[model samples]
Target: SRSLFVKNLNFRTSDENLKKHFTEKLNEGRVQSAKVKKHLKNGKNVSMGFGFIELDSVETATKVCKDLQGTILDGHALILQHCHAKSDDKVSNRADKDKSSTKLIVRNVAFEATEKDLRQLFSPFGQVKSLRLPMKLGNHRGFAFVEFVTKQEAQNALQQLSSVHLYGRHLVLERAKEGETLEDLRARTAAQFTDEQNGYQNSTKLAKKRKHMDILDKPDVMFEKIAR
Candidate 1:
């Protein structure tokens, strides 16, 4: 299942040229197919450096990536990866070709449910840390993803929620759409924390200094001003 994308390829390079390059470097007929993307603009075709190469197997793909990534190809380093699609969804919520979120799905709920409600219901089985409740036109769809503190919690919820009933509706919980890992969650949390910290550090220093002065009674009228 290792489909690779080669970036920074020569614009004029054809599938035959690319196949020859791979054959020289790897082995005979290792490449299944290779094609550069062409776009029609003003009735003229333009070649894009990016192209896909299907290898014989995942190991061969890895070998190609490890060997060719960062290697110079026509004045551009060849970047290779497992042909991940460009998506707006964060790494955790990536939508594959199927257009489904990588995160797990949770369904079958009472229309009045909230994230807090789901967490409470699932917390008994394990550490229910975070919950995302989906809404349509400002109405709860009766399903939510309860991210447990650990994968084991998620697995437990997958098993337990099927039998557990809340508000007369049986809860259905599954792994986050794409089986997102703890590292992805941590990275997201770290990014948010960095953003919040940067904003606070940049904008709050003067206000915080004024508040500190007021607390020390340096400006006695500051309290009155704040009260007013």
Candidate 2:
């Protein structure tokens, strides 16, 4: 069957309706079959407003596509393109290792995993200087880079925890590469503004400091408060 992938259909369009409508437009009995894509949501199959139209020949399919592409129905514009033909054989294949950072790249993390949880996972190896997860403007990419205080500690973590499962997915661990800087990683991944943007020199500067009216905006003013 020569099929055309279609999009932006009216939500209520059905399998028979799809074929019937296109068959009418083509003015021929060339439409062989039709299937509307559906979504399973909350125990119901919802129309996805897209589907496939199979024709008797590729020539007929192309003709219908050119004739009806962008035809509007219920204010939704239609998009039409040829569907990928199935090959006789079905096969599947799937496929990391890294470099000089006091850091390790951890992969296959669940989206819900957090920085604190990751810290606890490697804390026994050594003090983690910092941890960074690669993000696309605040979205988790399901991987992270952790910086131990020393390269030796990072190597240790890599040796021990490589291919281990955390949160039900096996992890791929390795030393981070040169390009993955902690500041840039965290700043880009963070949901809020970075410390530099807030006028602070860096995160370390405000990490911890005892406030004693010395916390006032004027840098030199002070009323030293002692712990009583």
Candidate 3:
């Protein structure tokens, strides 16, 4: 199963289009199949803007990846990283990477604090672009990310929130680098929907297109709005 893990795909790109483009780029018929991650909407498959391409062999896959990895396909940046082997199934999808951003990390979060509480706390500084608080067994992981529309807003919020108490816990703040890569984020979004379907969430152990051959095993889901 030699494949290329592609990311940052445009929403309009279809499976047939992916196969055709890769076949042309690689100048061969080694592409066995191409699939875009999809979401289930009233039983319909909605595009989730990321997918994979299967080639005939690892050498062909590697050569195709090398030839097309960073090339713009259908007007979007394509990050063609190597696909992991089936034996690597235990690797968590949330493992950290080097991508950086201006999102501030708020730690020591109150176990019961909600998104509203976080928005209220940071709103005075500026528009809160986005926020994410991971949970496990219905309890906050004691940390979250609050992204401001501007760096100054994030800085201001961090300063004001440095010592504030919420849910009876002092907030610890820091910056996030690139939060999550667009490709990984899409895969993460799909993995979250799959977790919700499975009625479990580890935040750190979510599967990424792993064991996706079955409908029950891999849910087709789009990224949810990052609002509460």
Candidate 4:
């Protein structure tokens, strides 16, 4: 295969680590080299969050790209595209990029479940970026947000969890909801603390969305909330 430019590598990663990771992805190639170039101004290393791999031929490279483009590696998307130039940076596509909004909403949880328990359940599907269980002081609300490394994995989790009962109750799983970006997830937690102190609820939409998603208005007890 023609030489490729693998950019966006982890700043702390070395050629050997990249080779091992690529070897796992290709499974047929010997990644000859995986070098991390130094920044020019102060010689500081910057993780461009990308990298390259050399295969025996163009056919192998194409096959590799086809297999791993949307996969997740090292808690980030393993972007595999034809290399154009050398520099470590992210992909130009929005779908391939991870922004502040990609996260999963896990509801109808057992009141006894802990943060560790939630992580253990979903970690098998993919790298969990974060697993947060809503707790007020020492109270468990039976709701959580388990953020997977990729959106596809999050969807997979929802499919597997829907209609499935844990602790004798059907678990509610779906996309966390719009307007609930990753940045504001924790913001609500902080705001909730203040609101609790002042004896009021935060104005964030998640609390209300959670209420609606649980289908609290439905009259039947046997009904399940379906994700759109």
Candidate 5:
């Protein structure tokens, strides 16, 4: 396929921006077309934070995948992979079965890390099917669950990211417990809410002090409220 799946895009990234990043910034090759997927939400078009790019040839797509797999753009790392051909229905069916074991529990995430960051961190191993960074009281709980499109991809991420660091903290990656889903993890974490209340007063004080500090304006704030 001459198409490449581009994931972990910034929400504000546009189709033209995506094309320019590849053609101008990276200088990879001519982009035939670039599109950032968007959907109507609350009567507004919102970026789905992923996109597709069509290059000149399969060779160009392969080169792009190799050279730009983890390139950062607009503060979000890009994940590039060759799009799978949909000609074989049997292969597609087989892929559906592979989803059973694709979930991973990511531990020790920096509470300041956003979904985009986690997606950028994991999408290089494979297409991320979905990701969840559970939040409580307007703050992330310092972990996430990521599901890749295939079990092998999930395993690859687990192995590669186990020793990786984000925001100066080492990451702990493990396969999701047998038959564990994101909802189950959410429930488990929710059960621990009472334990986290001990720090709630401190977090609240810090939040109040920093209320005027715009996280949107200064993206470098490192103080993250630990869930427990």
Candidate 6:
């Protein structure tokens, strides 16, 4: 297939921008078609932060994926992969189901880490299907979920980034369990912290930690209070 999957694009990147990047800026080859995927939300067209590009030939697509894999466009690094042509509907449905297993839970992320930072870190393995960093009070919660296009890519990232440090913090990467949610992760983290504090003799410190956990437990209510 001459088509390529482009991921981690800036939301503002348009279809013309994608075509120009490959054909004009890089001068690599002719782009047959370029499209930044979008959908209508509340009657507004919103970019999905990903796109597809079809080149003149498979070789051109391969070269583009190899050479411009991490090219930054509009402040976000791009992840490129040679995408296979779509199969029949049944196979496509199966692929969609398989995607659930490709998500990774990234713990111990630096609070200062941005989506761009993580995209750059993981782009080498494969196409990043999607990424989410839960936020609170204008900053991330020190964790993220990154879903790759393939389970092998997710596994590779897990093995490679386990020892890597960002902003002076070691990242802990693991395959996300099926049907897991952000609330589940928060509860698990709280449980781990509580277990670590089990033998502590300082009742005052324990009480303070428990109070903090209580605040975290009601995130929506806390956010509402802040809004008011």
Estimated TM-score for each candidate: 0.37, 0.40, 0.38, 0.39, 0.45, 0.43
What's the lDDT for candidate 2?
Answer: 0.65
Candidate 1, 152-206: lDDT as tens digits: 4355446534554455455565554453554454445446546877988977897
Candidate 3 backbone collisions, by pair: 39-220, 100-177, 100-178, 101-177, 101-178
Which of the two, 1 or 5, has more lDDT?
5
Instruction: State the lDDT of candidate 3 residue by residue for 41-87, as single tens digits.
Output: 45666664567788999889878878887778789988775544222
Candidate 2 lDDT at 81 equals 60
Model 5 Cα displacement at 16 (Å)? 26
User: Against the hidden true structure, what lDDT does model 5 obtain?
Assistant: 0.74
Worst 10 residues of 6 by lDDT: 83-92
- Report the lDDT tens digits of candidate 4 across residue range 1-228: 343444434446666776777677676755566654333223544443444566677767767667766555555555454542222333323314754334876667777556875675565445688888767679866667777665555655565445444444566775755567754665554565466646644445667887786676673642543431
Model 3 segments beyond 4 Å from truth? 41-44, 85-228
* Backbone clashes in model 5, listed as residue pairs: none
Which residue segments of model 4 deviate by more than 4 Å? 1-95, 98-101, 183-228
| Cα error of candidate 1 at position 39, Å | 0.8
lDDT of 5 by residue, 1-228 (tens): 687878778989999889988997546467899998665455777776777899988888888888888998899999876555333566556547755578887878777678987887677567998999988799998888888887666766675455455665677876766666789866765565556765797799888778756655555553443322
Task: Write down the TM-score for model 6.
Answer: 0.43
Report lDDT per candidate. 0.60, 0.65, 0.64, 0.58, 0.74, 0.75
As a whole number from 0 to 100, the lDDT of residue 141 in candidate 5 is 83
- Sorting all predicted structures by lDDT, with the top scorer first, yields 6, 5, 2, 3, 1, 4
Off by over 4 Å in 5: 1-98, 189-228
**Candidate 6 local lDDT, 91-143, one digit each (tens):** 55554677666788888887767898788777756688888887778988777
The count of backbone overlaps in candidate 2 is 0
Better of 2 and 5 by TM-score: 5
